[model samples]
Target: MNFEIVTELSHLERVCEQARKVPAVMLDTEFVRTRTLYPRLGLIQLYDGETLSLIDPIKLDDMSPLWALLTDESVIKVLHACSEDLEVFHHYSGVMPTPMVDTQIMAAFLGHGLSTGFAALVDEYLQVSLDKGEARTDWCARPLSDKQLEYAAADVFYLWPLYHLLAERVADAGWNEAVNQECNLLVSKRGKTPDPEKAYLDIKNAWQLRPQQLAVLKKLASWRLREARRRDLALNFVVKELHLWKMARFDIRSLDKMVDEGFDRFEVERHGSRLLRMVSELDTLPEEHYPEAIVRLVDMPGYKQMVKEIKDQTNAVAEQLGVVPEFVGSKKQIHQVLKWAWVNGRNPEKMPDLLSGWRKAYVEDRVLPLLK
Candidate 1:
């Protein structure tokens, strides 16, 4: 179990060259996202059967060698709960690891917990207890201690064994294709950049805003998204969501008024004029340019009963599958399905993730008929 810290370019190139020859590689990443829209990659941990290596992205200038190994579709990349890790890779190299296998998804198909943690899976299959104290460590900081290095190495060490165990169980259960298909979907989703125009939809109580106010919120959210990306700052650091909602809902005309309503001085000084201009222009926009108001399904008659029936059916399916109801289909996902089927004039084929791929056979069959 020898672990080598790779900080030089030649050493990384040699390691990646060796890793490319392996059938599979266990991988993990440590990143920080406290102040930026994208997570800043700090370290990469890799275990290619024989050698365990830690790559310091902070010290290395070029990671193209490692990225080449990651993008090699012929080699399998084994990871546990790899959503954020996939994001890190996409941000760094503009490419995602292909032929990837997520043990968490495999565990779900094998009748284990759907959102099982890495340490939990290790303890379950290999009887190893991992110290996760370094889970929140500032990996971007230099001069990492020996104990921290060991913890990072341990993250990917047991993944190799866990991948074997989970693959065997999933294959035995005849769910090999299902797990692979789901992991492919995970990779596809992680590679997509979100539409900044739709960021306002994520705001709480957004449905309560009027058509004109929704238009204002949309513009404000888009501006905030661009600013965050351009400056590499968190969205809140530019302008808090509460203030955005307040500006949209109320008739705050001037900077003084916004400051009186408790907007941050820095935000007021930076983007206050832009916000005011956007709000003022909302009135001049034509009626057709306004955003459509979000109609809550609960407000519609008989929709409550429809929601209850769908929840009961999803729960029954979860019970039949021996997994949690949330795992089968969360409440939010069910609502999205209903919105598509009823309001959006879309069919089950056009529905969201719940009715697609492997989920179609399990959940959609029971739920679609009721919606129709």
Candidate 2:
């Protein structure tokens, strides 16, 4: 029940050295980053049942030991819903935890699916209600209160036991092999930066736009992405989705027209004339210069049939497993699996890293067998 709070690098190193001797550790991170490019680690909690250590990354200048623990091939790193947490570790320490056991993934093996939030998992499995009132507390603030420390401690305190329970459940259900295979990949792969050329696909009007409009959309989207990364601002803060969709056509030749059309509401209004000029330049470029194939993916007639199959199969799979369908997989992933299947003439598992955990499960259980 006692947890040690470490605020200095020397203390953190000593704690990590001791932790490295252990077989496994339960880990959780509390960070503040809504306004920044990278999350600021406010608190990091690691527990090994008998001992708990809470690290203050703010006071600690060196975390190389903790990073070493993450990269240690022999020790298993345990977490729940580790995507953002993985990103945080990679950003700050330049290491992704290897040989991880994500309870979230194991929960899906028990049919809880991916939508099970952390508090909900604790409540359901551990029979404890969590105080999420401090969920949005600013982690970057100095002099973290006792309540904040308690909240942070709660995250990892139960993780050790939770992983034990889920590991057994997954093994009993004969899913450990599949799940471990995935965890290995998560541990080994370095996260890749998104390609700028494909960034426009995230735009709201990407699928609906014509080839010419898509070319313009790509240019503007690239500009927005670069600006957001350069200024370390949220994408919406630079330019809203509707504004980008409206400008995708780039038919408005004048800055005044854009202002009259509500583009002026953007905080980047001062850059209006300059942005208009950029769009105007894109307007002059040939549509052929853009990857017309990407826009064509959404319009292919085969996609409609794949959409229907994905919906029916996903729901049926969820029903068979006694879980909600959306948690099983998303419509977009379903489409991607089918598209990949068509080209590869093999299992959907052969698809690029685009397939999420849900897709992998669906492909292994349902789609692959049906393909035969």
What overall lDDT goes with each candidate model?
A: 0.88, 0.75
**Clashes in model 2: which pairs?**
none
Off by over 4 Å in 2: 184-190, 265-268, 283-287, 293-299, 302-305, 310-329, 342-372
The prediction achieving the highest lDDT against the true structure is 1
The number of the candidate with the highest TM-score is 1
Q: Please give the lDDT score for candidate 2.
A: 0.75
Provide the lowest-lDDT 10-residue window in model 2. 352-361
1-372 per-residue lDDT for model 2 (tens digits) = 578889877888888888888888999898887866667788888987777998888888888888989989788899888888887898788778887888887787687867578888888889988898888999889888889888888889888878888888888877878677666655555455667667788887567777777777777778878887798777777777677777775466676777766875553456677667777787567656865734344576666665676667778877876656765556655655666666556564566332445346554555654434
TM-score of 1: 0.95
Worst 10 residues of 1 by lDDT: 347-356
Q: What is candidate 1's CA lDDT for residue 106?
A: 86
Which residue pairs in model 1 clash with each other? none
Residue-level error in angstroms, candidate 1, position 293 = 0.9
Residue 73 lDDT (model 2)? 79
